[model samples]
Target chain A: MDLSLIIMQLFSGIALAAVLVITALGLTIVFGMLGVVNFAHGALFMIGAYAGLYLASLTGSFWWGLLLAPVLVGAFGMLIEFVLVRRLYGRSIDDPLLLTFGLSYILVEGVRIVFGSDGIPFPTPPQLIGVVDLGVGFFPKYRLFVIALVAVVLLVLWLMLERTRVGLIVRAGARDPQIMRVLGVDIGKVWLAIFGLGVGLAALGGVLAGPMRSVNPEMGTLVLAEAFVVTVIGGLGSIVGAVVAGLMVGICISMVALFAPEMATIVMFALMAAVLLVRPQGLFGLKGRA
Target chain B: MPVYETKSRPAGLSRRKAMMAMSAGVAALAMPRLGRAADDTIRIGFPTPLTGPFAAEARDQVKCAELAVKLVNDKGGIGGRKVELLVRDDKLNAGEAATRTLELIEKDKVHAVVGALSSAVQLAVNEVTRARGVIYVSISQSDTINEVKDFSKFTFHEALNPHMTTAAVARQTLKKGMKVAHLVADYAYGHEMLRGFKRAQASIGAESVGEILHPFGAADYSTFMPRLMSMRPDVLCISNFGRDQANAIKQAVDFGIKQQMKIVVPVILHNQRLAVGADVFEGVVGGANYYWGLETQNKTAAEFNKAFRTANGGAIPTDYGAYGYSGVGSLLQAMQVAGGTDTEKVVAALEGLQYDLTKGPQHYRKCDHQSVQSVLVLESKKKSAMANENDLFAIVANDPGADEMLRSCSELGHAT
Candidate 1:
């Protein structure tokens, strides 16, 4: 109830929101552009963490992991798009969803087979090991870094989507793929790149999250569900919607946890339901977009 | 030719008669095979979660149990019959555990059932095994399992329950007038641990500041961290297990809550410490059923450690892994004493049975079948002090007063 405590709680919510935004961004973009509901997004996130852990060990630097994990996982995503996802494009919307669902299981089981089920420790970078005196209260430096990193990512994403030619094609494709095809956009290649980028963003979220949470085979299962909730609440394909909804859900959970810890997990779903009842297309979703 | 004609005479008989003769022959062949299987091997059903969040601990348990089976076989087997292990994945669900236990009983015809990792899962397994009148040696921590309502004559608890563990831990750490807060996982095990801690607090006169119940397998604890910090308690008692414990502790450290208050987990797992790293777990104290470090002091522990290391590529047995080893090892030993695997006789042999397979001296309490053994109070070693990756904790205390720590039989609703 203290003002300082409330301020600290708000900061904690932002830190949580940072994680949600980065993770849900991938799902939003994939659904927005390719019209594919990727059930494998969570597995990709897990692979990203594992990839980061392995790469950090091999290169002896967490920085390299932060740099290369997303790239490697993104390449893997591109491969998946080429081999399996590409064939399902013109088919039933359920085709890609089901394929990705099965893909998630295979990826999780495959990781279990290779790495075993034990959670591997991913240490925080030495520089971010301690707490920062935030005037109201002390907070973990790593968390502040995450918040800042998410902001940078959001800005870069906004500039790219708004200013770059690739962004125009992606937005156009999302609106009308046939028009882009008529405009000689080669939408297939654009879809592949967008898939890779979306998956890479998910990997980035995983790498950032590994230090804060356990990195294991089933680590992504819960995150996947929460990410879905965020995407749905934000309007499935809206990047801006994901960012706004992520913050709203994060604060809602943290505030609810302060009063009733038992209802923290349920608060997000309740918020989503409330939003959908009033605006069926989500907060930022255009009419008939879903 | 006469012999052939004699044989052919039955064949030349009515076709119905020949079919009946063949059917009888097949029944005679199949009946003995089932009888021979029962005669040749003593099957012990091992049900535990091998697919969920706790799969790592469960798999280690299977390995430890396998080692026990191997040791029994090496010792000329149990009454000259081989001990067979039937392992099943309970999937960490109570319903799944009950179904698997039933299959192990009805289909596999296991003589005894051993192994369940979670407290809730074990209760479900106990129900199935008890109704079937089969011996069940539960390797999970649960206070409810020993109560008269859930307890059965055939049920035996090999792992230390939450009461013994929490009381032992609290006695060593808590003091008069200290402010304490509890972060409990909302489950049977968590609630039991909370009860134990509250009892300890009542005796010690520690002030209860706040209590928060989080869902099991929660991915983020940050939402609850600010609230916990707001309470500003002197000590925080975390009542959770497996990945939940690991994440809670890690996040507590992340939020700098460790600097504000001491964190005590009622039952800290070996795998959790390894997964979270020494730095995050440093200075956190808790009770463990077994610590491999006990080998230095207890000869029996040393022997068990040597054998376990030899069989497991030198990897030491974890706290829960020790449960698997001791649970199965003691059951087989009781069978050896009873001369066979009869449920009544083995049950008798197990009651008041004394052994030191992993931890120091231990025995099964006659009243509730709870394993009366030492609870090792362990403090996670600092990164600099750790000799190896496996050397995670330093034993602070080895309390042998387990009998005193248990709830009285009358209190457990058992007739005194």
Candidate 2:
């Protein structure tokens, strides 16, 4: 491959990594701290896209949609946590997994019933519609925006987790929920907030992805599978791991797809399998805490 | 893959005879309600994807089917029996499609079945409807459905198959000695499309540069875009559908592949144009089974378009909805000629059938039961040139169902 081709593919891989990282962040955080599988993560992501699309349509601005979709979806996520997921927090992992799986189906079908099955056009803003020449070759301006936006999100998330009191509590909860509970921090409320945060992050990713993809009902399915792969390969509950793994998976798939397009989807699973064979707890997973 | 199983294809067309015997016995036992006398209503079962990836197209199909039923019933019904539509959500699942086909044939006792959107779903339904000797009018585009090995006496495909569509597209667009690279979806439909293009290219003298079989629903095509751009082919033939097509188009534009090569979409869907933007599709030549813009040119198309728009709250219908309308209309025409819902008589009546619908004249090719109609070759105008909401494609060529546009029965593996 030529130098320009390599540069373009690497850039594309970075754009893909942006989506994968944002998408997996929510699932990883929820699974890491609450031990809830959050199978509805994908559905939440789809709902976010729809929400953003509708908001963009109503306001006639992609900016407003970006500003509001996450908050709206996050609030909705909290509602779901309060109503459905709250009861099964301390229960067997199977119960939450099964419940969220059902939720995922319900959300997908519900969207289909209401909005119909066709994908609505989510256009990139005119300002971001063209290409950006990067000394060597042209790249999509929208993809560059996606990369920047994801970086800001990751940075904000890092600061929130590392610099804030709530972030410390969350890290503590992930390490030992019983200790946090014993310390009189209403664990239930913390779980609810964390769930909402995770769901909101997924929605944010969905909104970001909307312009780059066809926002249909099943749009979430592909991303959901990829997020799961990212989570597993990165380490189940590690944010740092999700970020690292997301980039790795993205670059690997991008490089492979360049040579073997047929193996792009399968390669992620293969990567996950290889990672598991080498490190059962994932690259950043705690010992005995799959 | 069990979800895609049909009785005639239990082990992928092997053990066909044994499975047919088993299916027939089961159908005989389950179809106790088949003895219902010619009732006050004629039921047509429509199994479509109401909750899957193709749900949007399926909804349009269901609407078109309902409109057809309304038109027939409004005309005092076929032989004074009101047409009742038994619509079921196939969910685009092959297993579910089989079950629904059986349910419609047995319990609901639909006089005939119509409306399967997906190739896989239709293939699965074909096995059951064929075994039960029930008439199945398919709107899917699978060439295999009409093949002699896969054919059933009772099945009729109303939409253009991959070969037909690609042949029309290639003839309209490809010039001699043009370099072509195919970014085909890695699936049966995509393979069929590539085969059709290669077949057409053979006659036209177009040179094949390279081909990439990308996974369907791939999240990104950045890698493929640069590699494809590197080949520097004259034309990039995209043989994918739905979001994959849209995603590829968006990314291709992002990667500046559009500036390097001409992008040719064999099957340009309405939703795709909107998703990828009209600007991206500008000046690109392609073909589709139908487009609502035809209403301005053809009287029948005009009437259907007006009625559909009114019914759908100003939303114009696309070629997909055209399939649903024509499929049901053709089935009803056969029933009218047969003068009853008797399966054998209806089948015989439809053997050499011709009908005029949205397009001028269309007919079922007697050999493979594939619908032969004019494929509309269109060029997407610039965004600024779009006159109205549905004014997207500028019809450049209305290639009729000539000998070259359609493959021979032997070529389609349906030799008598």
Candidate 3:
């Protein structure tokens, strides 16, 4: 009702928006380039969080945890691709999704068994502890840092894809893998790189999420559904669409919480339904991609 | 409920015979001991959650039970027999609990059983115990465990039921002149607490605006907050558990609802304060069966608390530990009084027997087989009010007698 309260809520909404955009980025990139849906992305995200916790706890440095979480998660993804996902490369598309879905359970329950089924406290650093004062508003500094950090990661990711030879090759592969192969590009390495990149994005999301939420075994399972919805609404292969849609879903969810709080989660799903109804290919998706 | 279908004690202490044994004690003394060992070990089955959310609370209960067994054996073993604790993990699931209970009774041949946490699991196990005509000591506070279920002749509740817990908290809140609304988990304990609070709400001239049933294991409580604040109730009676309780309170704080409405948790939210931070938990009122910092005259309770904290490596919920210790403790006393492993006499002796609590100087009311003692009723500590880290609680009220607040065995109707 008050000016200050609404201002704070808006800031909170933006913070959540940042997290959503970053999470969806990984999935969107994979869907956009691969022409295959990856159901195990959520599980990859969870592995990143646990890896961060385990390694950080062992090393006594949060920064190391943050840096290595994505790498370890990416490595795990690489392994999964090698042992299992590689087999599905020439097979039906649904097989990959089904394999990943099964893998997700194994990952979730494996972590539960390893960690002992309980939520553990994963604290933000003392430097990011207090509320940062904005002239007419204030927000949790760690959350603001998260928003800023993810934004930087997104910028760097865009640069890597747009300003590099690898990006050019990947874009061509996305257009037509056969044409790229005809042009003498090594498609195997490109596929591996794309898989690794997708997993890295999921890992980044997990690392970013460690402090914001409880570092429990099933933390990623909670957000898996919303991440999928964000991918769909943004268009499976559209990075720009995933970005806009993630923020859209984020702000919409927060705003919905203001009035019908319980329905906030359902609001995201409803938004996806509406988007699909309006544009089956998503906001920025290609007709051919569908 | 699995029916192993052991032959019932033939000359039955059928109410007609039970009425006769209550006074005479002659046939009961002559009653045979069904299960006894050459090593003189009488096993008490502990069907508890050792791996889930109940693990922490249940672990304390288990430790306390172990301590009680040690104490009983030290003071000349129960009826000159050593007490063996048979622990089976039920995963806090109802079906698992029932299956484990049957395993404990039939395979393990445990004479008595102690179940910790999980109302559904406790209820399920209670049925199995009744059929086996074996003693059941349930540590869960759910009232339906005592009120709705067919309590076998062998069942004896060891802790205060939900009615006793909520009614007392309701009276306390209403006495301070607060209008109330219930924010509960959509489960048995939640429903029972709401009913008891509603009854007390009426008794104290307080009104109920409405009830909001939040799903358990909720990650956020933004939806419940607006309803709580919109209702404009003086007190929001929360009977939610673990993560839901933490998220609900934290969201209320973040959304600026805490300043708008007074929050009242009927049952204490265990281990959540530490998770959410002590400052965030400040000023929310709730009732717990026991507090780690009770500072009571009961040396055993004091020692148990100190020992548990030393062993647990963190703050332990006193309620769970007390129930666990007392469940095994009472059985040991019954066996001791019976002078052997005689089921009928041990059951007879335990029916109306009360233990001198090691935690506090109180008695377990033999009437409803519920503990008659003080409860930890405190508002969360504001940083400004803190005398020390452990001194977070401001003991509002001790627990009421079980018979006074709880529905009795006869009132709950019969199983046998």
Candidate 4:
């Protein structure tokens, strides 16, 4: 491979990794904090894509879709948490898992019914249509924008989890909700907020991904699988682990695609399996977290 | 308030009844009639992907089938039996298609089965219908369908196989000095397409610089874009259908690959053109099994086009639409010619049967049962040049059905 080609592949991998990081972050947070596997997370992501597509078509502005889709999806997530997920909090894990699994199907089918089965064309805006010539080679400007936007989102997320009083409470809650409750923290409110935030993040990822890919009902299926793999490899609840594993998985897939396109998707699962074999709790997972 | 509500009961009941009637009307419009039992009617089973990735195309197909059935019914039933089409949604799954084939054959007891958009589903359905000696007419293009192992006396393909379409497109596009890179969907259909293209390239003395196989429904092409750029082929051949085709073409445009090399799609769909938009497809040369623009060239096709547009809110018919129209028409014609709906008789009738539909004249070959029809190589017009939304293609090359373009009988392993 030429040097410039390798450089281009690296940037492409990073752009892909950026989307993975944002997608997996939400799954990691929800699973890490709530100890509930939201199978509908993928469906929520798809809803976000549809929401963004519809809004963009209606408003003729991708920015408005980006801003509002996540907010709308997040609000819906809160409602879901309050009405369904809240009751299953102390129940067996299977309860939430089964409930969410069913919800995922409903959401996917509902979207298919409303939007039909064809992939809605979510074209990249004219401003972001061209390529940017890096020193090595040209890269898609929209993809570069995706990477930058995700980086900004991750930075803001890091600040939220590290700096604010609420962030401290949320982090502590993820570690020990019972202890936090005993320490006079409002655990219910914390759970709702975190769940909403997690869902919002997934939707944001969807909005960013819509222009780059076909926005359809089944669009989230691949994302959901990738997000789970990233979450598991990164260590279930570790934000840093998600960020690291996401980039690693992205680069691994991209580089492998350059050589063996068939193995690109399979490589991620192999990486996750390898990580599990070496460290049972995942790379960033706490001892008892798994 | 409840004690005095009795006087308004009639008004409230009527109002509720009115709401119910309105809701029922909307529901009726929403649900497409799959089948209806009519006195003394010949029933035919039609299975297509009514949901999933191919749903949009399936709608066009079903519309064409409906139109064909309507046309037959209007002229008094074929052999005095009203042609009733029983439609089933296969969901693009092979298992579902097989199950539905059995359901349509056994439970519904239809005289014949028509329509399959996916090659995988078509093959599965073929197996089911073949075993039962049920007449099967496929509208999907799959070279393997005609292979002796898969071939059956009862099966007839209405759609042109990959060999025919690719050979036609390649003959028109490939030249002595052209360098081609192939981005094919990694599947049976893609494999057949690549083989056909390679054969064409070899004949033309064109070099095959690179070939990349991407998984079906792959959204991003960035991973392969850099390598393709480096290879710098004169043309990029995309061998994918529907959503995959649209996504790949759009991404190629975004990466400026189109500027560097000419892109040729062997088989393009109606929805795909609409999805990718005319701007991206500008100056691209491709081939279509059918295009609504052909209505102007053929009279029968024009009638179907006008009927389809009237039914579908002025949307022009796609190749899938034409497939459904012609596939159903051929089935009926076979039955009409045979004078009955016996599987063996219909098969005999369909063999070497020439007919005219939305497209011009076409015939099913006696050897492989694959349709012999004109392969249209289209040069996409600019957005400004298009008179209507569906007016995307300008027929640049019309390759007549040639025996050489089709796979030899020996190649398909069909017993002489």
Candidate 5:
């Protein structure tokens, strides 16, 4: 294989990995603290993309739409928590999954009605619209921008989770919600906030992803299953694990595609199986959670 | 909400009467005649996607189907039987389509059934039609539908298989001295098309430089743009459909690809000329089985277009409109030819039939049950800013109605 071609493949792999990282990171925070596996995260991604596109059309600025879309989708997440998801808390594991399963349909259908069933135009921002020639090879600017943007967002999320007061409260609550509640910490409010915060992360990922993927109502549904596969492979609830595993999965798939194009999809599932066999809880999962 | 699946029908007497008696016991018995007799009304059931990802295309198809019915009824009912449409929203998913098909077939007991717009949907409904023995005509062009292992005796299609266009285009390209090409296909449908395109190219002693795979909703073409430009083939044959075609075209232009290469797109992006400004897609060549812009004195085309514009307020792509038109028109014509709504007879008639359509003339081959119709070769003409339309494709060549590439009935996986 040519060295330049190898470098090109890596470029493509890393760009794809950025998307996976953003998706898995959002899933990780929600699972880590709340113990609620929100199956509807994928639908939220689709909604966020559509919302971004719609806003862009209305405002005539893709940049403005990108910024506002996440906020709007985040608010929508809070509403979901308050109205539907709140009731699922403190119940059996299957309740939230089942409720979210039904909610996915509703969300997809609702989006279909709002945006039309066809995929919407969420054009690349003018700043990142064309391909930029790296010294070695040409790379799509939007993809490089995606890789950089996701890296920044990941850094910010890490800082907020590790350094901020609210982040401390969230980590503490995840470890000892009972103790925090005994200390009059308004545990329910914290749970609501945590849930909203997790979903907001997903919405944010969606907004960033609008230009990369089409904003179709069912687009999220396809990715949701894949994200679950990633979550299981990465070790549930581990942000660092999710990011690392996302890149690992992306590289593995790309490398496999060089030889057998059809097996690209199967490679991810096969890798997940191998990971599960090696460490049932995943690469970074705690034994108790598994 | 009804959850009408394709299996709900039990091959009841209504269906039996519909298959046998022309207008006697079924209608006079007042047993809620499912299939209306002549002068009464011929109900054509449309199991379509009205609440899912395919809603836009499916909705447009429904309107076109409705318009086709109106045109037929208005110009004079088909063999004196008024065309009545029974439409149900199938949500565009395969499982739901299967379920809804049964409900429509059983509850409505339509004289004949028009199926889902997607090839996946058609595959699912094909099973139901085979089982219930209901005459089914789908608008989907998935060639596999005709060759399914268990061919449905009752199902027929007005939509030409992807193979036909692929083979036709490849032969044309080879004849035009464009040997080396690049293939950018839109996954499954694109893959199916590529199958035929590759086969055709091999026969002509030519091959593609490389193939590029893309998921259906891919928005950025900058990645594929370089690969296409680098390959620099004589022709860039893209196997994209619908909105993706327009997006790919824009991105290709941005990359300055079309400036150097002859671009060929299969499956005209219906209403794409209206979506992206025409100036962007000008000079590009694409193929279509039907073009609304074709000069035709047929009242059917005029009425259908008028009603569609009144309702949709947008240009209707020939794919959805023509599919719907042929689906209803072909079935009604077959029924008229058979002198009754007999599923077996209509199926037989549809197997090897010829009819004058909104387009000049068409022939449905018995071999693969594929439509052998004129393939419109159109080149995007430059548009003036004062115009209201998005594209003006200058008719480059009128490939005469000929033998469309087809799978032999037995070689095909079709089961009745």
Candidate 6:
């Protein structure tokens, strides 16, 4: 293989990883903080893409869609948490799982009914339509934008979690909700905000991804599986773990695809299995978290 | 709220008389109506993926089939017996396709079966329909289905096989010593298309630089892009269907591969072209079973297009959707020619039956029951050239059902 080709492939892998990181981050936070397995996370991601596409068409600007899609979808997520997910908090673990699984079907079907089952094209913004000539090879400008955006999101997320009072309470609540309540914090409200934030991240990922992939009702089905794999391989709730595992899975898939293309999809599952065998709680998960 | 006395009955009848009438109506509605003898209607089972990656295409197929049914009934429907279409969703899985096909045969008692969109799903449907001696007109492209092992007297292929379409496409596109590479979907359809392309390449003296097989419904093709770029082939042959095709082409353009080489798809879908828009698809060459632009050249195609548009809010019939129209139209035409819906009579009537319901004249080859029809070589129109949103392709070339383009009988393991 040519050295330049290898360099390009590695960069492509990182571009893929950027998408996985953002999507998986949502799943990890919701699972970690709320202890609810959000099977509808993929549906939320799909809804975000549709919402963005609809808004972009309505507003006549891709930027408006980008700015408003996550906010709108986040508000929707907050409503879901309040009206439906809140009722399942004290119930069996399977309750939320089953509820979200059914919710996924309803949401996907709802989109199908409204938008039709066909994939709708979302064009890359005019500013990002062309390629950027990297030293090794040319890459799509939109993809480069996505990678930079994800890096910025990670930095902002880190700063907010480590420095802000809300972040402190969120972190403390994830560790021990009862103690936070005893300390005069409204843990219920905190959970609602966290769920909103998590799904908002998913929506952001969707908005970014629409131009790259086909935007359809079932678009989230495969991504949901891939996101779950990333979340599992990363520790259940560890944010940094998601970043590392996302990149690892992405690179593994890309390299395997180069040599043995048939094994690309399977390689990620193999990585997850290998990781679980060594540390069942995931790469960065605390002991007993699983 | 006002309430009536419990014992009072309506002026029309007494309570006992009403109860008796209602019971009789319930019994009549509940009675199981089985077989063509119960009601003088010909039931044809139409199964396609309704909820998977191919849902949009499948829905279009259903629409086309419905149009065919309506056209037949409008014309008095095969000797005054109405036609009934029993539709089912195969869900794009082989197992589910088999199960749905069985139900269509046993429960619905359809005289014939039609419409499985995916190559693998069609085979599963063929297995069930062929065993029961039900006439099955498959509208999916696949080479293996035409082989002696899979072909049956009752099996009729209304869609062009991979060999025919690829040969038509390759002959039109390939040049001597040109380098070609393939990105194939890892399934029956993809493998057969690659084989067909390779055969065509060998005949044209083109060099096969590289080939990579990716899983079906693969969302990302970036991982394979680097290696493909490294190959530096003159043409990149993408052998996938549905969203996979759209994504691969979109990403190939994204990676600047389009600037280096031509991209050729074995099968290009109308709905997919519309969804992805004309910009990404521009200049891409491929073969199609039907193109609405053929309306200009063929009277039958013009009529079909007008009827389809009238029924579907002015949307043109898709390539795969045309298969549904042709498949059901041909089957019903055969029944009319035979003067009845008997399996043997219909089979005999369908063999070598020539008709031009859509896309000009076509006939089912007697040797393998494969539809001998024109293959359209289409080029995606530039955004500026498109007259309307649906004017996505310009017909570059037309292979008008030349016998030489199809595989010989012996080659398909059929006795000459």
Interface RMSD of each: 0.9, 1.7, 4.5, 1.4, 4.4, 0.9
Deviation in Å, model 1, residue A265 alpha carbon = 0.9
DockQ, all candidates in order: 0.65, 0.52, 0.12, 0.48, 0.26, 0.76
The digit string of per-residue lDDT tens for model 4 on B227-250 reads: 888888999999988888887887
Q: Which ranges of candidate 6 are over 4 A from the true structure?
A: B1-32, B35-37
TM-score of each: 0.94, 0.91, 0.76, 0.92, 0.83, 0.95
Q: Which of the numbered candidates is closest to the native, going by highest TM-score? A: 6
The number of clashing residue pairs in each candidate reads 0, 2, 6, 1, 18, 0
Candidate 5 lDDT for residue A143: 77
Residue range B85-199, candidate 3, lDDT tens digits: 8888998898999999998888777888987587888888988988888888888887455553555457777776676777777766775456677777777777777777887
**Model 6: per-residue lDDT, tens digit, B68-179?**
9999999888899999998999999889999988988887778899989888898899999889999999998875788999999998999998898898899888999999
Report how far residue A106 has shifted in candidate 3, in Å: 7.4
Candidate 3 docking class: incorrect
Task: Mark the 10 consecutive residues where model 6 chain A has the least summed lDDT.
Answer: A1-10
CAPRI-style grade of the A/B interface in model 5: acceptable
Extract clashing residue pairs from model 3.
A32-A237, B79-B336, B301-B358, B301-B359, B374-B399, B375-B399
Candidate 1 lDDT tens digits, A117-178: 89999999888988999898888999999999999999999999999988888889988999
Q: Distance (Å) between predicted and true CA of A242, model 2?
A: 0.7
Model 1 Cα shift for residue A127 (angstroms): 1.2
Error of 1 at B356 (Å): 2.2
Per-residue lDDT over A1-290 for candidate 2, one digit per residue giving the tens place of the 0 to 100 score: 68888888898899999989999999999999889998999999999999999999999999999989999999999999999988886789999899999999999989988887677778888789888887767788998999999999899999999999998988898888899989998888888899999999999999999888768888899889999999999999999999999999999998898888899889989999999999999999887888
Candidate 2 docks at the CAPRI level of medium
Please report, in order, the local distance difference test score of every candidate based on alpha carbons.
Answer: 0.90, 0.85, 0.73, 0.86, 0.71, 0.90
lDDT of 6 at B167: 87
